[model samples]
Target: MTAVLNAVPETSFAEYEALKAVLDTASRRMAITVVGEVNTQGRAFAVHVATLGTADPLAPAIGFFAGIHGLERIGTQLLLDYMRILLCRLEWDELLVEQLRSIRLVFMPIVNPGGMWSMRRSNPNGIDLMRNAPLSAEGQVPFLAGGQRIGPWLPWYRGRVGAPMELEAALLLRVVEEELIARPVSFALDCHSGYGFRDSIWFPYAKSTRHIAHLPEMYALKAMLDGAYPHHRYVFEPQSVQYLAHGDLWDYAYDRVRAPSVFLPLTLEMGSWLWIRKNPMQLLKREGMFNPIKAHRTERVLRRHTDLLDFLARAAYGAPRWLPQGTSRQHMMSRAIELWYRRRRA
Candidate 1:
């Protein structure tokens, strides 16, 4: 843990400090690895990957990622709060102990530290990490919003053509490939904000409207989430349902990995537009568009998602119980088609 802290810049970064504190507390109980590093203006940022629970190849895992877009600090804060809770409960939580025995938990809470530190949506190089992948959208995409090589000065800049991905993006995929993709089944949640008025849980094939091969699996997880929290208001669907984009890192990673090893990468768009509607003044601030500006509002947002994170942990631990099979899986597939694809067909 000392080594991890040493690798990070000595400068004060609140999110980094919180992450270090959580890792420090859980050091004795988990494995911590400094996966990679990013440097911006002479200050180096460490990308740490922490793993909790059994390392059995057969066990399911969940990878929690936030802060890919640095301006969306709520996503990073939500993850930090969740990790803080988990670390504090380590001594007395027997269920958590049991959970650790059957599942692997991976956290990469601050993937683009430089962007966060600079209060920019893109990394230090001005490239959007999410849009820096090698893949391109299959059809016509919405100008810059869909990503472009128009250059880094503009928003949604997809890095130079044929160039390698940004360091943070590369590191994220490396961590996912090593920690989560190696398992039989895994789900990754990359949290973000500023998409729409309602919260959403989006799964991939962001490059096209084509359904991912694991739609049934995704639907089963959605069903589990819905059944567990009857009144929850998360809209679950494919990313293409809203808009298609180029170089979505999750889509690239999901495409690289094949079936039998189900890797469902989901993006949790936290609906910061609702927050903006409540406080229109937030529009004036650079970070305002993507995060809740009020302290109480931020806390409420943080509190709201802990249950979802815990549910994801439990879902990974007990995937076999509700993942669906045979006719049940077919039913989920049919339902998913009706729910997500019907509009496209219409």
Candidate 2:
């Protein structure tokens, strides 16, 4: 293990090492699985899924995913930080232990380890996993930024037309299906960075401007966040509000699971621009666009999202209490349309 950890050049596999450390010392409650493997540069890396809490299919589950984009190391780092905290808390935090017994927590903290190792957005094959799903946007999308079929030489390259989903993307779907979608109530929070001036929490329908079927539930979740943390700076909205994209894995997953269950998949796009704004010199570095370059700023970013993660866990644990229904659902749907979709049409 030590030799494997040291083999990677320039700490490229540091996140993997940290994940291994957590797995090495994880409590019996945590079950670790390697869902897939990627062999690159003569070194093989495993994509891990760590699951905790109840095994009952009816139990609500919340999944925390990060490191989809290889350049966004901060997301992986923040998640690792939170995982370490949770493992330590399991030792003595009685409330957390009790909460875990009723709710399931899933972590896939490094979804694209090869991409991170190569310091590129795409995996070893150069396919963008986020855009590798076999789905397309409903209408027009933003040029190359939306996903293209040109080739892997360019960024946002979706795999060949009618091609199978990338291994990493497929593994992610399998985990979500087996662990989350099978349940009646589940939430997925996929962490990301490198967009906008303020932190944003985005829901599905990246394929179109149309509101998802669960807009009311999404609105209630946003409202819960607002009521609970009024000072939060996150802009909760649909991914379409910013721009449309093709083959969004979350959109595909949400569509597949929406019929018989409630699955709310959220992408937390942390505002890396703010970090660059504070330290304009970060522009000179490729990673600076998607991560905080300084130690102090990185620590602050890690601390900032801890509350949001905790809230999601608690919200999932007590989803029945806050999930709106009937008249309340209708009212929230109306307000959500007004807040998210209606104005855009005008």
Candidate 3:
């Protein structure tokens, strides 16, 4: 499992601070802390959380909560990619600089360690961190809302039974309680993958299509993002909420913690599934052997996602506060060119 994540070292904890070695990220001005850890096959796995800038306990915060689904490697990659550049260039970017002066950012890249190494959709305990969230009903059993169509019976099923934040969720909440309380994130973007639909974005706990007071602002943010990402636009979809699924992370973000969080599950569902369908453990094989092309393409694709993610993180950092205009159209056009180059090779 550790070998699968070629970039991030395969590691297990012998002590609480074992992760500190890998946490090249900072503290104080920038924070990197271990929010949770889950045991798998007798090995301890830790969840590392980070922030781009100073954490103002009083000012509102914006955050990215991702990778609750362990198999969704892309989500964690995107988060880490965003953080890599954000940690450094933040001070230079006018918008992000202002955001740092005014507000804070919360980045929880890997919300489910147990599931990631195991290459399973759910945690070691078989709980989908995304669905394990507490429902609004408080103490009541989870149920469908609006027009949702997902449940435990599905592939990404929630646990047989447990409270919200039952395991990973609870650790995440504790992190929020201790660190985000001062800022209490006003906005959250949770990233995932597998659907591979035309880059879509869904808002709030449910997709009922009801007008959320913040939709305008949310759309505004999307529109600004669309400026550079014309080809990449929110699909206003998923039906994960209004369509089906009770214990989804989006709902938990809204109904449970009282934050406005949108779910952006980037489904780069390329044909890898086709090969994997023939052999479920196909990806588990050495990249150099099973599918060298995919392995190479995966690295390249993540580089692109990393670039966009950094742009988005910078944009989010500058929100409402005033961020400098993003890279010029020429830069984006060049990016398009790079995509074509890769596509041509593919």
Candidate 4:
């Protein structure tokens, strides 16, 4: 374990090797599955899904996902750090062991290994996985950043029209549907970087400005976060607030699960611009734009989000206690609209 943590992985395969090491250590406690494989160049990269705790469909589940964009490797690294911590604690953390019995934890730390290996934002075929979903935006979107169908040569390229989803995107959806959407209550946090000046926690509706049906639930979750961590800094809102994009995977997945079942999918967009601001020299390199170049900064980034991740896990475990109800739900809905929607309208 020490060797795995200390070693600096130079390639996506090395990152996978490190993950396998941690999985081997906790093999007895987890149900590990290789959902699919992405063949790029001459090598095949296997996509893995690992679950811990009760398998009951009614139990609350929380999933942590990263590495959808190959350029944003920090998200994958952050999750790997968290997974290692949880796996190590399983040996002696009695409280965590007890918590796991009542809740489920799912992980898919490296969703696009081929893209990671190539150091590109898109997959080997050049299609942007996040933009490969069939969904389309209802309102006007930014010229290209909002996603385009011109060709894979451009960034944020949606695949050819009427085509099936990319392998990585399809596999990710399969894991979410099987492990998360099936549960009565579930939460998913997908990590990412290379965005704004401050780290932001964004919810669904990347395709439109309309609010999600679970606005009250989203408000309740944000309220819990505020009450628990008063000093924390996170812009909690819908992804549409920043920019509308076509084919957002979360929007597509969130729409599939109906009422009586709740699935709150979030994207943690870590602000890499701050790192660039601190060290302007990073602009000279492509990877540096999305990742911290300095070791100390990287360590800080790894430690920063652990609390939020742990809080989400605890929140999922105690969903019934905080999820809004009846009158309280109505109040939350009003507050959510006022806070998010009304402001945008103005």
Off by over 4 Å in 2: 1-12
Structural similarity to truth (TM-score) of each candidate? 0.95, 0.96, 0.66, 0.96
lDDT of 1 by residue, 1-346 (tens): 2354456555646677778777888788779999888888888888888888898988999999998998998898898788778877878999888889999898899999899888899999999998999999998889899998888889999998899888899999998898888778998999999658899999998899999889999998888899999888799889998889999999988987866788989999999888998999989999899988887888888888888999999999889887878999899999999889986789
State which candidate, 2 or 3, has the greater TM-score. Answer: 2
Residue 42, model 3: Cα distance from true site in angstroms: 1.2
lDDT score for residue 173 of model 4 = 96
Off by over 4 Å in 1: 1-10
Between prediction 1 and prediction 3, which has the larger TM-score?
A: 1
lDDT of 2 by residue, 227-346 (tens): 999999999999999899999999999988856699999999999889988999988998888998887998999999999999999999999998888899999999999999989899
User: Any residue pairs clashing in model 4, and if so which?
Assistant: none
Predictions in order: lDDT: 0.88, 0.90, 0.52, 0.90
- Cα displacement (angstroms), candidate 2, residue 235, comes to 0.3
Candidate 4 lDDT, 245-345, residue by residue in tens: 99999999999998889999999999999899998999899898999888889899888899999999999989989898999999999999999999889
Better of 1 and 4 by TM-score: 4
Displacement of the residue 266 alpha carbon in candidate 2, Å: 0.1
